[model samples]
Target: MRELFTDLDIFNAIGIVGVSLYIANYTALQTGFVRGQGYVYPTVCLIAASCVLASLMQDFNLSSAVIQVTWITISIIGITRMYVLGVTSRFSDQERLFIRHMANGLPEHRARALLDNGMWLTADPGTVLTHEGEPVDHLSFVASGKAKVIVADKTIATSGAGMAIGEITYLSGEPATATVEVAEKMHLIRFEADKLRAFVQRNPDIGAVLEQNMANHLRSKLVSMSETASRAPVPASADAAAA
Candidate 1:
């Protein structure tokens, strides 16, 4: 068998690694594995550029050096912009609370996109948020006040702050699972289904964060329901039979 390499210098190895990174990064972007909006892409490009620039010390190429330097400069600019947007982003109190609770890991810019697409509203008491078996037009996050989750006109649960409404139908494109009625006037963050779906399709990272948030909230609700069921008193007839 013939050997592919006998002796590879450190600088050449670094340059090869850089080439690999360049190829891999581009491939990841094309394959939907990495997003162009975030820091990871630019950071990887910066590192790759650095490696290629270092390799130029071993065997200089003016054109290659220029390309690498340009890549490095562009990458640096992109990274700096993303950082600034995340750091200098402004948010209101309800926005801050919503981001902290449901979309904690989102970059401020993306969080802003989400919040901007949604509207903040106050629902008066007796407002019908969702109707049973009807298509839900939007998703709601309760910033304040309370609501009842009703099925067949029976109250099954109370939704308060930090709870997500219509997330299931938002994901499934199904009808509302239950009727939600505002018992007390509610401050709400509402995202229309069409807009949210479009945004999520365009920015999947935000979708991922939202999905995770929904999963966590649903799990907690399940746990609370389980506890409530467990605490229910035994029936009198059952208790008498046990005695």
Candidate 2:
């Protein structure tokens, strides 16, 4: 085993596999490639293993050409898996709706701006959409499913489809006050915070849309909280009735 790994060719092959695996893993993990799907993790493992195999077998006698073929096959599989994940992921439906909804409210130029920044991807449960106290990098728009907004200890508000998130951080230019987590599989579109600021500075119309969306989101949350409060019993009133 030591000799096998010590050879320069083998080492280089291993290096190739290692770097490729890192790229693949980052792409999947950062971009929410495996949300709510069993195949994503398994596929990642398979690709990593294949890369190792390709590295180890390339120098063997009596089938060097065959080893190359296997390497190509593994790479092809990896690419295909990424495509499948993208096409069939949670974002498909929500992305369409996101485009349509934003289209109604935004002109073509603003719509293009949204994509030019960052865009939609699906995330799994337990994924931290954004962390409290982290520098705001991007603004995320929830396209589908739910996210938990942690306001205080044991106090959380769930934001669902069509809600805009991360704007508070963007507007305040401060670290997030609370963390956002994916409560379930969620599809989301995002815009780079810096790019958005620049765009907003240059184009007042785009800025207006962004501000409007933020207002709308705040209003919705307020309404939801109000309704929840209204449904709760007043302790003093209840005590008087009991007396």
In order, what lDDT does every prediction score? 0.89, 0.67
List ranges where model 2 is wrong by over 4 Å: 1-96, 99-104, 232-243
> Residue 126, candidate 2: how far off, in angstroms?
0.3
lDDT of 2 by residue, 173-228 (tens): 88887788889898888888888889777765556666776766667777996787
Compare the candidates by TM-score and give the number of the best one: 1
The superposed Cα distance between candidate 1 and the true structure at residue 239, in angstroms, equals 6.7
Q: Summing lDDT over every window of 10 consecutive residues in candidate 1, give the lowest-scoring window.
A: 1-10
lDDT of 1 by residue, 25-73 (tens): 9999888688888898999999999999999998999999999999999
- TM-scores for all candidates: the values are 0.88, 0.52
Candidate 2: RMSD to truth = 18.4
